[model samples]
Target: MFEEDYKRRFVFGSDYGTSDYKYGPITLGERPAVIENRGYLPERSMVSKILGVEKDIVVGKDVAYFLESGADLSSRMIYPMRDGVVAKSDPTAWRVIKELTKFSLEEFKPSGFGFKGYYIVASLSAIAPRYMYENLINIYDEISRETGLIHASTIIPQPLAVAIAHKELSCVVVESGHGNTQVAPISRAPIRDAIVALNRGGSEANAITAEVLKDSGYGDLAKEESLVRRVKENLGLLPLNLDEAINYAKRNPEHVRAIYQVPGTRIKIDLAEYSWTRFLIGEYVFDPNHEIFQSYFKRGMPRPSDTRVGDITFYGMLDMAETIIRAVERCPVELQPHLYSHIILSGGNFMWRPVSTMKGIAVDSQTKLQHMLRDKGLENVNVRLSPEPQYAVWRGCIVYGYAIPANYRWEWEKMEGWVYHTK
Candidate 1:
């Protein structure tokens, strides 16, 4: 009991995002350290000969070294949370997740004062299954056994973490990351039954951007996913009206035309006549049902299909507006209006900025969501982007860790409070 009391002083937050793992103790001010949520399992020969290390897995920045060693990246690299959830049977994915957790804790493990462990608050997908939670708990327990890195831990939904960061007890959180989008309604506590998961996000935007690249004669460059993403970030435009935006681009092709130089390379891509297709990238994310996107699907691009991942049915073709409505309607009617009024957008996917030069033509995520809601008869809707969408979950973890009472025991039914892993 005394040891558990001592552990409360060092609180840590870990956000297991699809693209990156954001983690650090509460002392890590404002933001947490981010590492790509990936790992590389070094070949047995290399581990024994070159590195002289017995560890089988390499994580975070070290993964890049293995990549540079000319290993077949496809076989060696592992992205555990690529789809935001790991299956029970996938040992490789589980290993990556375990290594990531260990890597994070070790980085900040204080050396002095006979450190006991850390009180950790970890965030996961809102629709994560019981098995995923169990898997994570087991992983943390293993780390504790090996290094005494965890005193206790608790897991909360990513959307709930975002809500906690903003002290929004009653708001709808639309968190879109690289792999998927989660729309969750909260009224003090998250309405788990009402949560909606979408199999679309920034990655989908990247896909459309790649398609645009192929159409613009940069077919070879499109194969490089990272390069295609950079081009998309630099050139993609969210249109106020998709049809009008395309027509405007056609009329003033010179204004829309752009040349993007790869940051560290001399290669420059000139989207001359094909610049108009840039709007399609953003449009596809909000509403893949748009007629324009059909061409890409027909031309071999994989269509986003509805999938069921452990009780949560992810809608692939639903637009942002319809998704919000679908999720909100599941809650009590009395709470629906309040949720609409405080619609909070949180995630990397919503961190888009309006191109000021484009003026009336360009739109930011908030404006786009508002317009979509209004079209669906949602009047006086207030959709706002999270102040720090990318770090909101991490921040919430910090706050949750600090606020939740150390004595409060975990209740499976409520799914809140600290779960004491080490006595």
Candidate 2:
């Protein structure tokens, strides 16, 4: 009872996503603390020395204080994970990750009786290599020894964590973020060998949005990535049928037309006559092979090309349904049906909702994926958008840490269990 009570209070969950990091202790309830997964390295000033400001790297929202103007800020800011894997030799990236971890731990460090340290469960990308695991564990070890903020730590795949959060042990988890998408089958544990990697995600949606902006005479604004993303999120509509939705938008211009006012600024982007281009953003994410996209490709908008990462080949052009099908088929024949019956979509990339005004023309990710799969003759398909997709991984981490026995030592072969002892 004592162990269970202690675990419930002290277990910490960290989700290191491509665009953001969500972290907190078990007591945080449903949501976790989020910060852009980037860090800023500040150049020491003489005034800072006099003030006794000694930290080398600044993380989370506090990075705003150390940020430089224009070009310098961009150069100093480091985003550790691109395709969910950090390069082994990027010392600066590693330092940022370490600082971010320590920063979060320290921020929530409990102060009271019987509180020695936290037992942390961190969720990483499914395709993260052995070196990533090693480096992360080493960082945790160093932090534990130095600060006594971590009692034990373990890393689980983001997809598996999603499955745990949703309580779907025998399911397929499609985790999409800014840089890439990972479709992994989880029977009892994540079937790493059967994972399907995709080099397309929210960035792909943003790419099409930029093109739409350029074609619609917002060429100057299209150059800004952040503005492009905001435009994509607000105006992008996932269509039931790409061609059908395009026709609907072209006809009922008033209903589908988008006017997004940049928050806190007078800038309002109105896709007046070019509102039909909105469907292009969502369609490009699901299936970019449509001939309409060829014009954009011809016009010098770089296509999402296939890339190889270790043993996995992240496909660029394959539709989402095809990608999921390919991943599920890699598993045993008997489990395929079970896997198909419970499909969970988790992450910021899958958060788009269908507009009520668009009706049959636009559909959410769940409906769109279901239609795409049913068209391919997989009748047993069931897809669900994870609840509060942003918090799923972190919640799973908390549940994982709370349930696992403390005596179970880290097993390198299976890559599950806790590290009671660290360097």
Candidate 3:
């Protein structure tokens, strides 16, 4: 049996990120977008964009900042949704969500549980347990009652929410997020039973690139991971003459690729570029033979049934593309037949195309991606890009908010020791 004191009647979906929070207010009727700046106080301009309210209602700093400044402190707190579903498991993360929720409630509608409807669109990982769901409901119930409203809540799988947000009935969703890279199989307006998550993601990609730069005689260039990312975004690509480029770097170690200016430091504006002679730094995405993957041999190759990453050098843009393709190949073949029609590439990683440059080559990450997907025999697969790939999960939650039925309700005691499933 579940405790009534811990139940919320409505479902709300949220996609929390490192820099911002994307969520939707879900009820029986209309669903509205809810965006918040969890990183810092949002500017008035940003709040105006999301709330769609007159500037007079939201004068200056974002809701949380304004509330913390003592404008009106009685408002109850809302839970801060995080990037991955389980991020809240961190103690520090819980506190952050608490503060962010308070900010959310202060600016918009006053949150409460007494309301007739409430449902949650959370990551599938978030709803894995009955007790976890119950605790989340209890938190919301307290928040609602403190603000003088009734509590009602339910949850939607995050991958399913993302699919809904993308409006794709059949596709392979590859989310290269800040914390983790997750690939889920979906079809016919629903997620398939097969899904995979890897410890690697954008953060790891950046870290690895940074580490490579530091170790390869470009120590000064290595620390600027963010700048390296910007350069990668603007200039990274799969070189057409992959072999020549590899040979070139090995020969002319002094050739400069790009120059970047580091702000507010005595460090002179640094010219950052990779030369063929210098041993490629962060080029593993292009070269399958890069030394990084060589460690897999020492650890022993994974059994075919095991999904472990192999060495893939950044020899060209194809390296990044191969990761996605390889992951797809690893999926249970029986789960996704040849009929799957789409491969929805989401995340900031797929943002550019490879183009030729004056000094050297530029690898278009996207072109390599498309070519690899086609070559992998999923020719029926069409590449679908999620608008604002970073926020797709959040948008999915917003979409899920609108989809809940008016009669939907979450009765915890009725679901004793049972794993509940709904759509």
Candidate 4:
């Protein structure tokens, strides 16, 4: 009975990404439940007053219902990790994170005898400050006190989690999410000093997509962030050479022209004469320094600015090749080769597919990176996407949770092990 109960103790892995929170108990096997990382705090309503719904914060899928109710979503809705880091002063963002944690834990909270709280491993941005870590720990402690929902919890960097997931101890992990991208060199452990962060990511791609929409006479729909993102994912194409690709696209407009229909809506977007510009979206992601992007900057698109957040510096206009080279060079010369050879691209931003119709012209992320490296005289570089880029961090969390000794206690200095919560 003790053994059975021990086996039943909840073990969860949570990847707290800027765009979505991917979480599940390790027992669920491979996949985890993905929910928008945003939360909605509903205003006090007559029904709530009568029902005594004190906790107005709603997280995950339920926020959709609140949004549909037309209850001032812009003011009420809160995205915790808007830029991969939440300020200590932001209570609403912290509340959303806390609610997200509670929702996930309660979802798989088992029912039976000898039930202890869950052992969870949460992944965060590589550039997250020490204060952010402390805040999360305090939040978890509160959750534990309110509901006994956590036995113990620890945090890991998202890129490190990606390395753990792929079992690549000595590789450069480039984790590109919606808000930003982190390039971390891991040799058994993350090389903290060598990590590079980029201010640009998927959202930047969406920005360019919005520009393309406006150019294509869809100026009204350009403001629809979700629609613009969908159009980007469906129609965007990364090319071998931006200039050549654009010229080819201009010459052969019929081949590149395509239309994307927004799901669950009657809206359809046609690239039309602007079809060639599709390549610009993907090109901008890899090399934002391209002169073509200058037009958008002139037109008032917020150019990705170099900013220092926490202990890390996020470069605004750095190309992927330069970013990788810069990060790897910061490490020991002997270890740099190994790091360069095994480049692990993991994240939603790297999720690119080949355009079957545009086979010769279209290149996936790996191919693009490989070509970029080759151009810089780097050879034998093996760049590949994580098996499940979206789930890699979560999987790594699970593996980490299982491997960590039960008796281990949280240490502030090392930032590992379990944080014991006391009421």
Estimate the overall C-alpha local distance difference test score of candidate 2: 0.90
**How big is the positional error of residue 393 in model 2, measured in Å on the Cα after superposition?**
1.0
> lDDT, candidate 3, residue 226?
48
Please list the residue runs of candidate 2 whose C-alpha ends up more than 4 Å from where it truly belongs after superposition: 43-55, 421-423
Q: Rate the local accuracy (lDDT) of all candidates.
A: 0.87, 0.90, 0.46, 0.87
lDDT of 3 by residue, 1-423 (tens): 132222222445555543345554543233334453332232356665676643222211354444443322323222233234334355444545544444454444535544432344544332234544555455556655565322344555455656777787756776655444456666654333345554444444454445445434556655543455654443344443455566664554344354444456544333344433122322433343555445532454321121332221111223444555554565557645542456676655544454344234434444445555576565655556676676677667655545544344555653312122322
User: How many angstroms is residue 210 displaced in model 1 relative to the true structure, after the best TM-score fit?
Assistant: 1.7
- Predicted candidate 1 versus true structure: per-residue lDDT over 174-287, tens digit per residue: 999988999999998889899998999888999999888888888988876568778888988888779988998999898888889987789999988899998887888889
What stretches of model 4 exceed 4 Å from their correct place? 1-9, 47-55, 68-71
My TM-score estimates for the predictions, one after another, are: 0.95, 0.95, 0.60, 0.95
Better of 1 and 3 by lDDT: 1
Residue-by-residue lDDT tens digits, candidate 2, 1-423: 776677777999999998899999988888999998888877788866787867788898888777666567567778888878888999999999999999999999877777778999999998888899999999998999989999889999999899999998799999999889999999888988899999998888999999999888999888766789999999998999999998898789999987999998998999999999999999898899999999999999888889998888999999999999999999999999999989999999998889888887888999999999999999989999997888899988988998888777799998999986432
**Number of clashing residue pairs, candidate 4:** 0
Q: After superposition, how far is residue 112 of candidate 2 from its true place, in Å?
A: 2.5
